[model samples]
Target chain A: MSDEVKDPKDVLICRCEEVTLREIEQAIDEGFDTVNDVKRITRAGMGLCQGRSCSKVIARIIAQRTGKNIEELLQNSYRYPVRPEKFKIFDEEESHE
Target chain B: MGMSTAYYLTLQGKRVLILEAGIFGAGASGACDDMILFQSKKPGINLELAFESLELYHALNVDLKHDLGFENYGGMVLIKDQKELEIMEEFVQQQRMYGLDVVMLDEKEMRKRQPHISSRFIASTYSPMDAQIDPFHVMYGFFHVAKNLGLEYRKKTPVVGIEKQGNGDFRITTQSGEVFEATQVVNAAGTWAGEIAAMVGENVPITPKRGQIIITEKIPMVGETNLWSAEYLVSKLRPEVKTEISEEHKALGLGFAFTRSFGGNYLIGSTREYAGFDTRTTMEGVNAIVKQAVSYIPLLKDIHFIRAIAGLRPSTPDGKMILGEHPDVPGFYTASGHEGDGISLAPITGKLLSDMMCGAPSDSRLEELSPVRFAVVKGEQVQ
Candidate 1:
């Protein structure tokens, strides 16, 4: 796990952002610092699907680099209205339906 | 006011109730880019509070035992011209004086860090203190922890009316004929704070400032750092500052800002318009973001936009949050008017409001954020 993420040409870790392991390593090499740093610079996890797609791979890369266990790594916060529902659904009479 | 306040209150062993018009993260909290930055904050209590919140964010995941995807990506404010360089120079001085860890990055150094940055930028300022979090997870974590501590939540409930009882209690009637009784009512509603305050016959000079965002298809890290134009600071603090940008764009409050989301999408935005509660995304706003963002990071021009979105930020005329109890209404309190900083300020907002509600001495900073400040500012005779 530690040495596996060094290759920048690795397969897409995040398809939504189109981030690769190589770019993640470059972000870290360029002093991007933390997992969130790589996410901000390379967008490894910031995607339309909201990282449900690629966070695990990105986390694995981060764990490999930082020498931290994958389980110990920080995950992104979740927001409410977590489900996508239109405002019309909240209308008093409409909500009943 | 509702969720975070409930969290701290429940922790204090108090009975708590939460009523949401929609599900959590539905409002500004969910829609905002998860940046907890202090560089552009209005240099006094706002920066102080942001610093406190930054500390809270650092420990929050560990404290709540939830994964909040917190990271210090650092932030860079681009200086596109000599005027902007001067402005950033002064701004950096003020920020440093306020104990912020900010350093000026010349064009060469800035380019070294963020190679994709435009050559049009002469200089920039970098701060490691700026960071991002997944707003959805933050809210979810807070709600989960609060609920476990005995917080009661009723979703799909909208307050239709408010009546004051003879004993100083407030009775809130939801649209579905549900009634909620409480000794005090805190208006933590985002853009709807004004309407909530009006229900108690109080005025909280809050407005809905619409901010539009554009999300790009996942691509390699084209730009480094959470980037913003020095104009963003100018627009937020002194809207009158003149720039070569069109009056139309200026009116829309367009400024360049781009950050990578945890999901790999680049969330670039935004435009601030007083759209009277309308949260719809406009072509003009989205176009401005695209034009300005591509100008700073030319690589963005080749990328396709995945989605265009907008959110209504709760803003005050004076650009400060309104916390504490309303001056006239005994138990009717306010914890709104955070503007774009709401996501960053939620933790402290909740704790401070809860402290006041629990009969603890008010934080001296709360004195300035008093709901009464607006009254004093207007010199309006409180009837």
Candidate 2:
């Protein structure tokens, strides 16, 4: 929203996946209206942070462009393993036959 | 499944209305890997239909005018030991005889192709015909084109009832009390298709088989081709090998499938368990997949997985999809129960079902996949 930011396209919205603002805008223009749709098309919210870092930013962008409410757009589904846990943590016991 | 069916039907100049129980790509279609695998298929109608389906995907990429993220990166089946190697050897030969471009790769050749693979794998099979397409892209591609061609769809509108009138017409009632009347109906609800058929007094025998997959952050390519384990394939092809698997692994229905998405994220999967309709990924399932994957490709342990997701695949008893008109329920059709093969066979299934509806003569081989097979097995009349 600020003109001080030089070339918003070059700015990275999703640091984990390194998706640029331009990529997110392009996905929206291509008719991917929903936040989840944009995430699926462009790898914006599908990284290590799991969209916690960029989903709101992307939702705001969708609202500004599509005139849809940001509240409605931010209804992205959350999955299991709330945080980044190691695979070894879940490997407790193995019963080999 | 519903999207593809709608696309084909609309392309044939028929007015189509899609009643969705949820948003776009909300079910298994959204949560699945982008694999249109060929090597994993059994050597039968399943394999034959996959070849045709691959051809259709190529055409759909052009017809839809959108990048479906179609890629022919090929696939590999890692053979862990001599037992799996022996079984895969015969499997590959049979698939080759059926005109598949598949071959067994010795350890030397396999390592040359996939240097990152662990030394535990003795050999592998390679097929140049194996491919992948983004599920979201494909589903939305069909939807976009079909919508422009007069296909109307309502999201979050679940069908509550389906009744047949005396004059061979269908009355479809939605959960919102909205009623729709059509001359024909297609139960393409995937996992819930059995419930849809039951409304009309037909038994489709579709069960929800849950599969879980984990997604890693963007990483370098692990191998030249998408990967699968002959361990699971062998077990599926020869169920007698179940005794060799551990109880935990058996309960998890563990297998190895690692495919990279167009976005550079490696989607490592999965488990095949009958957990009814629950689509929640468990710690046990995710851990098993991670252990199996790390053991196969040690480099994977360093990658950070971002998310875990689960989907319920509509599995049938015979391990084949039901795709035809219900002989007892006239003017009604069922195109469900693809299990894991739904992504691979979506295009062909839609085309065949639409062709059948339009009175176009279809491949006689499809008769084996008909819903009537269930009835005939029950000693009912053939026609």
- Identify the candidate with maximal TM-score: 2
Top DockQ hit = 2
State the lDDT at B154 in candidate 2.
85
Model 1 lDDT tens row, B1-383: 47778888888888888778865556897568888878878679999998887777777778788777786778999887887787778879988998999999978889988998777888899998888887866876787788788888776688888888999999999999988899988898888887877777788877898998877665677556888888767655555777787889878988777887765667888998988888778767766677777678876655667567789899988888999998678888899999999878988888888889899986786798998877533455433
Worst 10 residues of 2 chain A by lDDT: A88-97
Q: Model 2: what TM-score?
A: 0.90
Which CAPRI quality tier does the interface of model 2 achieve? acceptable
DockQ of all candidate complexes: 0.05, 0.42
Question: For model 1 chain B, where is the 10-residue window of minimal lDDT?
Answer: B374-383
Displacement of residue B341 (Cα, Å) in model 1 is 0.5
Write down the lDDT that model 1 would get.
Answer: 0.77
TM-score of each candidate structure, all chains considered together: 0.79, 0.90
